[model samples]
Target: MKFLRKASGLLIAGLILSACGQQQAENQTPAAANGDTVGLAISTQNNPFFVTLKDGAQAEADKLGLKLVVVDANDDSGKQAAGVDDLLQQNIKVLLINPTDSEAVAASVKRANEAGVPVISIDRSVQGAEVVSHVASDNVAGGKMAAEFIVSKLPSGGEMVELEGIPGSSAARERGEGFHQVMDAQQNIKIVAKQPADFDRTKGLTVMENILQSHPNVKAVFAHNDEMALGAVKALEAAQKNDVIVVGFDATDDAQAAVKAGKMAATIAQKPAEIGQIGVDTAQKVIAGETVESSIPVELELIQQ
Candidate 1:
């Protein structure tokens, strides 16, 4: 009878221990859950520059054993907002975005902010919302370098066309500012035609063709990005105006190839991959409760044949 009583007490203790163990397991965070997922909202994948940027982010995420969810906005502000909304629904640990439109992205950023998800802006910026960090090249400096290159090629100072990026975008505004700063200093250098191509290759081609029709004597062209620059090169070739000096930003693969073949005079090489990697790293740091700087500038260089 005493042996039976002891066994009953032991059984009760064992059951309690098992219940405690199960409760502890339930309280612990899941190994493959929220902390393991990262959301990346890219402006567009059509551009090689952004494609490389996304690849860099993905590589870094893989190295860190994190799952990255990527969404392309296709350069549409509305689509970008919707994409961020979708990512928010997935309970992403962090949000890294290359905004299609700086101002329009603020709403998405605000939503992430409300959700308590840290945001790291990559390559582009958000206007109104608080961001944990921004990772990109010094675009203004790159623009200045491009302008100087064009000026150096045309020592006598001549008419040039400026193929701007998407209107209201930070890249477009800052690059235009930097280019104008140098060009304005040179009284002899004149920008005959300045128009926005929305940083698209097709629009760049059409815009360049139209500008060529109006300003055939334009001596040089400065495009805000490689895609636009390549399109401008196409138009120049078609018009047999190959002699015009062309300077472009973003040393993408195609741009480098063009430079090697002497189709493009030069390209300011912004490290898009580095920018992307740093953005992901920053997101991780923020997720780990670390404070990062508001802005992180990647290195830039000039590439020529």
Candidate 2:
């Protein structure tokens, strides 16, 4: 009888341990199973434009009750590839990339493709990868607008300089192409010196300073993005070339303020926040297995003083 009582107590303890183990297992559900999660890989958050883009995406994701994981590459393509790999390992339902360099980002995008994680490009397109949708402004048209403004300001066809963005970037290539399409046709207009500043303000200042040494009489300047434009403005200010018409893209707050202060001639507003919001919305549709546009264009406008 005592032996039977010992067995009963042992059986109860074993049953209790089994129940606790099952409860612990249930509590340790995967993060993805807790909620729908998506990943956003940005080229760089150091820039105000990309910061706003990230903010926009986060806001929308929060409203939809989704987990939005973000990673910043700091403008390094290799880091972006590694970041994408990390996101893929996290069981992300979708991946959004704002590539630092379009070509270099392809390997990362292809890896996402192989993992069956759909990719949606934001603000910039990726090369050699399949994407469910591309969310961005019409950069080519924005470039054309900048060129037209420069032409209007320099109706007599004067020498000007261009500060290009990062080399091998779709934004740089397309914007430069659009600018040339308009400026090259104007026989009176001349691009005296064009150089890449990698879309950085400090580099823009340095490059503009160097260009001034050779083309001091340049009547106008167009920078691919606002940071470079602001940099060029600083360089021109130091040289006291205040009358030079300087135009820029990505009408960031600083650039807009500069325009209002009469420091910059104009800027093309690409509505980065809208781009980010649309990107998340598109991701939702893609997740729902719904058909969406292959390319989604956000609005663009010219901001002038």
Over 4 Å off, model 2: 1-34
Best by lDDT: 2
- Summing lDDT over every window of 10 consecutive residues in candidate 1, give the lowest-scoring window: 26-35
* Candidate 1 lDDT by residue in tens digits, 272-298: 888888988777777667889999999
TM-score of each: 0.88, 0.89
Model 1: lDDT of residue 138: 83
Instruction: Report the lDDT tens digits of candidate 2 across residue range 1-305.
Output: 99999999999999999999888767642432356789999999889999999999998887666699999999998899899999999999999999999999999989899999999999989888889899999899999999998998888888999999999899999999999989999988899998999999999999999999988899999999999999999999999999999999999999999999999999999999889899988887777788999999998899997
Candidate 2 residue-pair clash tally: 0
User: Model 1, stretches more than 4 Å misplaced?
Assistant: 1-35
RMSD of 1: 6.6
lDDT of each: 0.89, 0.92
As a whole number from 0 to 100, the lDDT of residue 277 in candidate 1 is 88
Q: What is the C-alpha RMSD of each candidate to the true structure, in Å?
A: 6.6, 7.6
